[model samples]
Target: MPPPGGTPDNANYDVLVVGGGPVGLLLAYQLKRFGVSVCVLEQHEKEMQDAYGRAIALFPRTLEQLDQLDLIEPMLQLGFACRTSVTYKDGERVVWTFMENIQDTTYDFVLVLRQMYTEQILREKLDAVGARYYHGMKCVDFTYDENLPRANYPIVSTFVDGGSGEQYQLRSKYLVGADGGHSFVRRHAGISFEGDSSDDQWIRIDGIVETDMPLNRSYGAIESKTHGNVLWAPLDHAATRIGYAYTAEIAAKYPGGVTQEVAKQEAIEAMKPFKVNFKEVHWWTLYNIGQRLANSFSVRDRILLCGDAAHTHSSGAAQGLNTGIHDAVNLGWKLALQIRDATKLEVLKTYDTERMTAVQQLIRYDKDISTLMSHKWPSWYEGDRNADPYHVLGEIFEKTASFNTGLGICYSENFVNQTSALSLRVPPGSRPPDLELSTPGTDQKVRFQHITRNIAKFWVAVFTGNINATRTPLRQLRKAYAGMRALPIDAFVSWITISASTGCSPYEALGMEPFGNTYYDATSCAHERFGFSLERGGIAIIRPDGLLATGGPLDGQFVEEYFSKVMQ
Candidate 1:
């Protein structure tokens, strides 16, 4: 018998997020942290979150973003910090490196962990944060109307409980589809997933295993003759991920079709001279590689798509999950800002604009990387066919290393990223370098990222130059900012002041009370790192997602000017 249908007292929310994967959960978690009531529905039960291989790596930039949410510390405890990779040929060690190009952040290594654990951490924190989370409850149907009297809660979604056979409706101001690539929400929302699919098949197997190979604990690959590029990566808890191309040769050998045994045997074959023994097999998968993106991310001003639901691509670059994290981080604050101020509809548009473009760039890189991994040269490969794919891959990887690490990801000029007068090594729409700073009285050092947690506010960082010399501007800025302290954007802005000394007291460092948080750039390296002089300080507006909005000479007018365009 079907359970009763009724909108429970807690049914209504500010946002209804469909899908409870890492992306959906993180987005909902952030929305709740930003004071927005949210509901996250995942059709799958917790145990079934990921029974097979999915994303296994978190890049440096993503780690930084997670730290911004204060979630990385627990994640670090469950993940392996991978800083080195070594490739081998015929059991001979060969030089190969990854993620060495990443800089400006304390999270400088690729974190190796299972997707389930990552999801578990998110689920636990989501509960602690008090967001509505339901597993085995699927969004069966949803509708929206601008004509509704409660325009703030115009989205009504009906969800079916898998266990009880019960159904009910939850209303929200907007609906976000974080469902995976084969998204029911995307299809229902009439959003078209557009892109190309390739016939390349790949296999990934994860297990607690023993390997004779040196540096087996790090990320490495074998130059497999039969299986193309073979991946060897150490995961948390003594497990290793073995991945290789499931080419036609492997299929031919498995005329009866492949099984777990085939996945195991082929992995052994791919490793060649390296000894392999699985103590316990955990998860494995055979999947096709494809690249696709939703034609639209935000729809009808009331619906949005994120994570795999908005874009899809091969996992060749280890970017599938990382890019999704970026999507959620980018969208979370914007959604929070919009939900708080409905008139700020313009900010939501940038989510589609920025992420779509970024994901498009990701697909291009993955396409090249995927084709190379398939042991096939792309059509654009003008080089000799006899050239080693590894060599070509190395060249391309070196070129795209910064992007691959998520540090070089840049956005074009928009309302959020406008022209700035301050000449900084980092440009607008790019992330500022993560440097160390000291506390006022305690003199405790902290990462700049640790200071600017993503709290759904524009962090106005006022660089108060050597207070002994530039105290006048600090005093002047203090006066100018008073007139704008209670502006309409107060709900979305934060303040921090940094000076160039490890003064025992914050008041002595700035010659006045600091605006928000006070930090000391002891050696002024943080200033030089951001391309500013400690002798001549300035102001920088960092968006909630940690991207530098704009910077200018020590003045509050620049910040006001930047927000004028954003709020307008």
Candidate 2:
């Protein structure tokens, strides 16, 4: 907890992540994977309770990002798949929403699992890499030195052990606040959490239940005359989470008494015509809702904020954890590159810009969804035609389906996502579509994401139309790759040749010395999905986080210019 007693030094750790929740754990995992020294600090003395009355929905986009770390399969094994969202009004199904694999993701539907389990899986990944995760140690103060020597640690963080009251000082090149809404790092950094709080309160229950409702098998909601709006979803084991709003009258009903017994009674009363029996209760909570975002995500190009520390919103939309996971993935690899000095300092700024844009959109969407679910219509939509709350919520859900599923998340055009003049189908700042391909001269098939699994480096796929045409670009790229050997660039950049020709092997054309492994777009899906014309071959640079960075003509100079902008 005392951080092993040391002064802040660059030789120690490159990055110090506060709060070992899912986001912090993920940041640590990625940094370690990138060979960057990282240490995690958790304020809690031990693992918190399964108080996962919080985030339980893992959208498809999140699963795709998790696949990059090879952690999705284990999570899929421990969670339930929620493909449909059913909403009922007065015990009759009114809006049944379906989330398909429209993005062509490996994990199509939302996975319902406790947040604790999600954190555990990420912690296991960190443990596998021998990363340090210290619990009970909380950051009490930090000092940022902008003028310090570049080789030395710029941020000096002090921590104290909750158990022994021992104090320790640690140093890092970067400090990240992944702590929750009441984050000390955010407050100490003097960053403002801007937003408003809503009066709508909610109570949630998770446990074994017996219900006559036929739609309880998956994600469902109920809009009742008596209960308000209730969320129904399956959980790990034979458990379910039933979350319902608490009206002013209901709050008054429990006025001198709000206990588990009272909550259970209220839950039963709210279900109206459907009979719901609870055999056991695992967890329950009563809480208010608020929407807030940090004024900035990163400070001085070093101190950063993520997860609940960066933003907060109601659980009604079930976006709290899902959005936080996105924040971690977006920032993790960027920070790793920054630590290695592989990317320009300005490149790290995109972490703040891109994620802030996404978080702000989430806030706007959550505001509408929360209001509708609470049966409180905003002033503009109060007419009889839009009277029904269930109908309105369904409409908003349809409109914002992309954000909800994490598929529609596309970063704004920036240094990293310049418009590709090559006219590829996948635009810069958007994730490359997942398509099936195979190794050169072999029948082994693989998903396009398989090539994108590594988070520490960028992958440049040279789509040469034929083996003969690959000779020049391959030779030039091999020379460029050799030039990068002197720098730590090899740690952050990789090259691969993808041939559209079935007659010749990509391995023989490029040789295995420079390009690690050649892949064949035999099915022609890659060619179509990437908008690659056989006449005009192109090179697509996939970022460390699996987003398309840039694409242009298949020339060595074009590849060098792309790397020159991002790497040292």
Candidate 3:
């Protein structure tokens, strides 16, 4: 199928995402939300099959992001809520309870769902947003104009739609390679993936099992020495998902060592101790474990890499999907800014620097997790000795589990300064917290999520010292930003006018502590028990990711000037 007119002169899209997996879908959704035109090309015809039961953990941070996007409720309805995770070693339970302790936080539980299901949900969302997708279209080659300056006309891509014998050519101001491990997009862009591919072969099995022991659970482990070290967890009421990792030497010893039957038998033997028995197997596959990161996220300017194209690690912590999704969220808004003229193309270059650093951190963390869980004990009985093994495992589990849910991500180092007081108010790369405020004339309470749907403009929270003096400027600012009235000011920003001396709470239900004593209430006083100061009269500039862009003393002129320069 030709482009109808054989590739129109200016048919280039605002952004070209290479992969229709969850990561690419998210990128497309976020861009569309910002009113940017985007297209995703996937090498596969449809969502992945159930045989690949990968990605069981959706961290709290990711859940919070879904909530902000209005996808969390749907996701929860489809997936299982994982409140506690158990860790076992040498047949003995080490950490039987790993509960996330973030009651005061937005997301406190990880959601467990298969990667295929996750991709399906994201695809549905992408469709609703009017984002286009080309399935079974493989990107074979890509080229960038090195002769041009860094951010100008940098990348071009060539794709072959498998459904129809058609060759398509497209140009993009920004190109993201979300394609999996053997990424053709990343390779064509001349990016090198640096890391090692272990000779270990792991088999993952998902199936229904009947057992007297508690089933339908989420657990991690470093056991099964007789067969191989395996990590196991539950998929649903009838089926459980288990991964068996074996060394190359052992596999070489047995010709049929990596078969599903072998893995299923091993899993069955491992579960016998817990009184769990397998009745039948539904799906299984052998996966090679590799850990690698792209040397750079971008080449020249237009081509960038994310997800498995950028990094891959062992399946111990289920970090692959989480990291990939985070990459999509990070790059989406930046690309949208350039596409919508809310920011210059220069902002796009920062995507590589920021995302690459985050990926590297994940790689390091994954390595640590693999090593800690793979340690072997002399015997299953040893797990009963003195609680020392349990203690050691507990410490390791705590460290591995301490990863900041995507919500805790901050972009303080690149493209934005974190030390400025203004920056502090608006976390540049952090997720913005949902705040409640009332509509000026309607007396209706408005949420940030509702207001952000139609308006994608950057917000400047004007925190005036006195409510009366600020009213005139607030009204004037609103008039000036009338075109952007669809976007609401967060309650924290609107309540700035209330004299800090009044001690009035703007939205009591949110349990928002006053900026200082002037707005303190019983809840605010209780929040003070945490030993953190909540000062008032400061402005916070938040980025699209909901993180504080910057914060400082409220200066109307400075706010206007900042927007004029960035939005130009």
Query: CA lDDT of each candidate?
Result: 0.84, 0.80, 0.61
| Residue range 1-568, candidate 3, lDDT tens digits | 1111122233577788998778888888888877777788887766344346667778876775666576777678777776766655554665455554544344567777877777777777887887777677888887767676434545678888776767888777678889889888888877888998655566778877765444236555545544454566766433677776555545665685567677777666655465555687777877666689888887766677878888899876677888887787767767776665556656677788777777777777665555444443323333454433335545655565545455455554455324444324334565555444344324454444334322244445444334443444444444544433333332112222222223224434222332221222222222232121235344555555555555555444545554444454
lDDT pick, better of 1 and 2: 1
Residue pairs that clash (backbone atoms under 3 angstroms), model 2: 8-171
Give the per-residue Cα lDDT of candidate 1 at 350: 85
Point to the candidate with the largest TM-score: 1
User: Could you tell me which 10 consecutive residues in candidate 2 have the lowest summed lDDT?
Assistant: 1-10
Cα lDDT of model 3 overall? 0.61
Q: Which candidate is the best by lDDT?
A: 1
Please write out the lDDT profile of model 2 over residues 1-568, one tens digit for every residue: 1123222232357889999888898888888887888989888854454355567888888888888887888898999987766767777777465654245777678898888788778877888887877887878999988899746987888988887888888888889999899999999999999998889888888889999997787688878755667888889777898888888988887668678887888888777678999999888888887799999997887789989999999987788888888999888888878777778877888999999999999898788788777777865674684467767777788888877888878898897887786878898999888888786556688787777788777898877655465556656666766675666666677777676765455545444353556777765668778987766667888988888998887676787777788776
By TM-score, rank the candidates, best first: 1, 2, 3
True-structure lDDT of candidate 1:
0.84
Q: In every candidate, how many clashes are there?
A: 0, 1, 27
Which stretches in model 3 have alpha-carbon errors above 4 Å? 1-11, 47-51, 89-92, 145-155, 220-229, 236-238, 248-253, 376-393, 422-457, 462-522, 525-536, 561-565
Better by TM-score, candidate 3 or 1: 1
